[model samples]
Target chain A: MELADEAIRLADLPAADRRTIMILGHEASGIPSEALDLLDRAVEIPMVGTGHSLNVAVAGSLVLYKLAGLL
Target chain B: MELADEAIRLADLPAADRRTIMILGHEASGIPSEALDLLDRAVEIPMVGTGHSLNVAVAGSLVLYKLAGLL
Candidate 1:
C-alpha cells in the first residue's frame, strides 16, 4: 500500500505540498462515488455570487494559482 | 471631483475595497489605449505555468473571492 496511509488533503493542502497533488475535474453531479474511493476528500469551492456555475478551465486555473500561493 | 482623486488600485487592491472596483474584460490585444486613459491601472494575474491565458469568468471570480477574502 504505497499511498494507502497517505490521506488526501483535498484542495485544502498547503501550496508547498502540491508536488504529489492530483486534480480530477468531474461533472456537476460530482466525482462518481466509485472514483471517490480512490481519493481521500472532495474539494469544494465556496461561491457568494448569484451565479451558481464556474467554467472548468477557469476553476482549474484558480485552484492551481491558489495551490501555488499566487492568488 | 466625485471620484477623480481615487486611483484604480488595479487588481492588486485589497478585496474589501471592491465597492468601487470596476473590472473590464477585453481581448488579448488589451484595453484600447483610449480606454486606458479613463482607467487608473491595468490589472494582471501572474502565472507560472506554460498556459498563457485564463477564462474571463474564472479569472473574474478569483479576483472577487480574493477581494472578499474567501480564497
Candidate 2:
C-alpha cells in the first residue's frame, strides 16, 4: 500500500500539520520506500490473535486520544 | 455519542449522498433517535474477545469493500 499516499489523500490537510500524523500498521517496516519520507512516525501494535491488525480509524483514534491525553 | 454528528462532520459530504452511508457499531440498536433519521443503515459485528468492536475505519473499509463487491 502507498501508505503515505493514503495518509495524504485521506487527511487532505497541510503538510506542516501532517508532521503530527502517525501511521500505525502491522507491517510498518515493510512500507514502501516512497512512504518513508512522508511519515512522521510509524507505529506497530502488538497483537496476539490470528488477526494481526487494528482498523485504521481505531488505531488513529487510539493515537489521537493518547495525544489528546484522553486514554 | 452523537453518531450522526460525528458521521456528518467526518464525511463532510451532502445529505443526499449520506443516504448511501451506513453506520456500524456494537451498539447499533442504542443509537439515538436523531441518528436513526440520519443513518442509511446500522450494522453490528459479533465479537469474540473482550474487545467488542472493530475500529471505525476497519469497519468502514469492510463495509465499503462489501458494498463495492470486493469482499
Candidate 3:
C-alpha cells in the first residue's frame, strides 16, 4: 500500500492513468478495493499453492514483463 | 536473483530482450555483473540514508513507474 501510494504520489500521474494501472497478484483479497480504485485495474493471478502468495518483487516483475511485451 | 531468473525462464524471452532488463537499487554491488550482463542495463537509484535499500517491491514499483513512462 505504501509503495503504491508513494509511486502514485511521486509520479503525480493523472487519475485516469492511475486507473489504467493493473496490479496482479494471487492474494488480491487482502488488498483494499479503495486502493484498487486508485489503480486502473486489479487482477488476480491464477495460482495453486499451499503457499498462496508470491514475493512482491516477483509479482511486480511478472506483471511488468507481460505489460512491457517481453512475455 | 531467483526472481529475475524465474521471470526470464518462465517468460521464455530472447536473450536480447533480457539484455534490456535493468535492475535498479542502492546496492548494485551485491548483484553479480554476469547476471547484470543478462540484463541490458543496471542502474543505481541515488539516495542518502543509513538504511541501505528500499523494499524490493518499492524498488520494483519505482523502476516500473519510470520505465513505463509514468514518472
lDDT of each: 0.54, 0.44, 0.45
Compare candidates 1 and 3 on lDDT and give the better one: 1
Colliding residue pairs in candidate 1: B15-B67
TM-scores for the candidates = 0.63, 0.32, 0.34
Off by over 4 Å in 1: A1-13, A25-27, B1-13, B25-27, B37-41
Q: For candidate 1, write residues A1-71 as lDDT tens digits.
A: 01223333223545655364545545355555566677644455655668665566655656667677676
Model 2 TM-score (2 dp): 0.32
State the fnat of model 2.
0.13
Model 2 score (lDDT): 0.44
**Candidate 3 local lDDT, A1-71, one digit each (tens):** 22333243322322232324555433545556565566554444333347656566755544544444433
The residue pairs in collision within model 3 are A19-A40, A20-A40, B19-B40
Model 3, B4-71: lDDT tens per residue?
33233322322232224555533435566565557544444333348666566755544544454433
CAPRI quality level assigned to candidate 2 from its DockQ score? incorrect
Predicted structure with the largest lDDT when compared to the true one: 1
What is residue A38's positional error in candidate 3, in angstroms?
21
Per-model DockQ: 0.35, 0.08, 0.16
Error of 1 at B39 (Å): 3.8
lDDT (Cα, 0-100) at B16 in candidate 3: 38
> Which candidate's TM-score is highest?
1
